[model samples]
Target: MKNQFFAAALIGLTAAFGAHTANAQEPQRFETEAHAIEVTTFASGLESPWGLAFLPDGAMLVTERPGRVRLVSPDGTLSEPLEGAPQTESFGQGGMLDIALDPDFADNSRVFITYAHVEGDVAGTAVWRATLQRDGTPRLVDGTQIFRMNKLSGRAQHFGSRIVFAPDKTLWFTIGDRGQGERAQDATDHAGSVLRIDRDGNAPADNPFIGTPADDLIWSIGHRNPQGAAFNPWREELWTVAHGARGGDEINIPKAGLNYGWPVISYGRHYSGGKIGEGTEKPGMEQPIYYWDPSIAPSGMEFYTGDAFPQWQGNVFVGALKFQLLVRLTLDGDKIVSEERMLEDLGERIRAVKQGPDGHLYLLTDDPDGRVLKVSPAS
Candidate 1:
């Protein structure tokens, strides 16, 4: 009877994933140019793990897209789902997303999370902060809503939610156009912009658009669907990876009060091979630092400043969801020197990439049976 049940489950899985069965198997040996590395499965059986954050004690917190948070130990032990997580909408591309720990997490156990929030018939992206109590059964305490997208749409695509903290401890996050392309050009709308706010969700007094048509929280405008964000310590700028319609995947450094040129100017064309907006460049809008003619569907990104891989120092790493690989970009002062693709044989959607406290590279795969993987120098 057990064998029969197992056989039935296999059939169900095959039916569900028909053409994508290649992504369900164990990861294969990865190839790299700079150094020999080993990919170890740190933890397994996570359901579509979307975000990863490391605690000072070496433990990690992972967010599952279906509205669950799990604590993972250094020794590969997965704990029970934490309680007190905010309710998520969990629709098409919506659910529990990025997880980030406060810079002073050692003093305060505060953690921040982004998720799809729904109220009645309308839905949008929302961020929340809470204190994580790790005594026995891990749970959240004093959860507070920090920010919410100004425009709510009924559609369920393009919630570009990625969070990063600046040196001043101010929080920055991205929001997609919510599938409404024209709204990205509107400064007053929060649909497609990078927002900067204080820990208490207040706009800083130094904001460029304060008292103007643009919302005071907005730092940059004209974005599509940015999924990857990181603070480059070397350049001291906020970098982002955003998705385009058909081709035009871009890497941008969002600056205050600047327009990024979305629908009005795009390197990518429509999915139907039609023109997007104007041409790729205009007089006032900014061009991307680098763009991909064929989209890779980029996700989480991080700059490598750790000592584990000296050669990789100062390089930027990004995860590719559609291409199912990890991208290493060597940069010469923001000009991309070269690009290398790694872990192409992993056959899974690389949802997030992060550097562990131990200086190792960590990754979360997006799958029904997702996994947390650690990359180290192979002995």
Candidate 2:
């Protein structure tokens, strides 16, 4: 009788702390309109995998949040952790983040990565570039720190990192608000801005703020914590997805020298239900193309131009962390015509989305025992 009573009490305590429980529900399948797709586990045993990049030879490079990068062969074999990755500040929301192959990777095996780093007592996001040599033992050579966030903060959250190459061959990357709202309005700071730089981390001569108080590297300002960035090849525009405090999650096309209006004009309220900034609109600020009122917590995104799904051509796919699903946004030019929630049955936090070289969509689930899932037409 005594043991039964104690077990009952323990179960009650666990139920009371339900908010702290990790959602580890198993993956499930669902049907789509234009195609019947099957979601298959491509690779498993990844410790919180955050990013995925494909090499020219169909191999893949995946970033694990606990500061490791692993190579995945086409046959689903994961290599031992690669060497020469930087020592990252891995805690809370910080760690090894996004990875991208250099545009000329066929000629130059250059690769880029973003991660949170600590110097002394301060921590911030930093971008690095290195040559990946596959001869004998695969390793990174000539690693260089390309860009580091300007204002270091003790806060570990909101390291908005995603990397994409522009049509002009320059690199565009994001830096979040660092949990400090007012910093987004400061031009002198690199936090809360989308920055553009050359392959060697040099500020482009044609940057809009060359002579202003703003940093020369800043391309656009007033972002909260933008995690998703991609270039539309057809439109030649840069699109970003950002997180809001409580409700408003947004998608914006970051133009040169534009202000995105985060705290100063947010559709989201504080977590405590208090109003943020000036209540959602300002004359000089640019509005998002679309927004979510309840906050989906979007992360990685990509525009689909693959041949696997003909009906999905030109649509935008974004990963949803809070909702544990994938969002497919239909686009009619610059406007978002409709949104379809997908893969909800997976019941896992979808962290990143990338269209593979084989014209199928791949996703990374965020969990200690995370996995890489591939979506293809159902057989």
Candidate 3:
């Protein structure tokens, strides 16, 4: 009998090797400047899988945007949607979003998730913490809503909400302007900012904006709509990829109390082919380490610090939704020196990119039949 749960995984991976019955495409390999890489479907039949995280044991946790979480065993058995996920609404880019395990998940059994919490017509970005129970039945319990945006909006767009744990153990999350451009410049508004808070949702004492007239959780202001965030352990700084209006997708290393010139300055034109924000450079705003013109609609980002491909170490990876490809950025210390676009023929809107513990690159596709793809070095 054909295995109903999963196909055979490669590289000793314990995660999905593509859904047994749903995947049929042959794996493909592409040559790059540093190394030849192979892309294979690790799992399929996922509905808009937005976020992916690997557990210590190599099992994977995946979140579907329409509001569900599931466990994918290495052998390809998929768990039922875990209960106790926060209630959310899905419309115009709002739904259950990123997922991250507690830094000490092995000891705490805690997990964090970001979603669009709905209240009437108002929907806001929210973070919910829960204890993941996998004994007998897989489910979430002891749920706690650790954080929610201070001001909810009726609009369903621009919920920038990728979460990462800083080296200091505090949580950092992104929020967009909720389609209100000027809102990003407001220090008091959570929208259009990078926020840092304790795991319990309290602002840390040393948060840069604490004594200022900004919200306690606000770390930096003037972001457009950041969808991808990762902490570069090598530099001990937070890096983010944010969507631009028409042509100005940006990659910024947001700093404490600094403004990132969104509505004030941008490299791309407005959707109407008009000028944007003082023509890209201003006196007080920070410039992006790099940016994309004619916007590729970048989403998830990963800093390659894995051992599988030693040459790829110190590189950066980003998934592009608009162009349906993966981007590898060659960085020289803090500066991005070159960019190579790959996997354009994969034919999926790559939503998120994750570096697994084993140092392989994994991705989530954005579609009704979304999938988890694993990228490894090609021999």
Any runs in candidate 3 off by more than 4 Å, and if so which?
1-25
For candidate 3, the per-residue lDDT at 174 reads 96
Model 2, 10-124: lDDT tens per residue?
Answer: 2111112001212344445569867788888887767888999999788889998878888887766677778888778466678899999998989999999999877765689
After superposing candidate 2 on the true structure, give the runs of residues whose Cα lies further than 4 Å from its correct spot. Answer: 1-28
Model 1: lowest-lDDT 10 consecutive positions: 13-22
lDDT of 2 at 88: 81
lDDT of 1 by residue, 1-379 (tens): 1233223222112112111111233434555889888787888878788999998888899998877888887777777677888888456677899999998888899999999887765678899999999887788989989898887877677888899999989899999898999999999998889899988899999887998977999999899999999999988999999999898999999988999999899999999999999989999999999998899999999999999999999999999999999999999997898999998887879999999998999999988788888888876
Sequence-dependent TM-score of model 1 = 0.92
Model 3: which ten-residue window has the lowest total lDDT?
Answer: 4-13
C-alpha lDDT of all candidate models, in order: 0.86, 0.86, 0.86
- How does each model score on TM-score? 0.92, 0.92, 0.93
Backbone clashes for every candidate come to 0, 0, 6
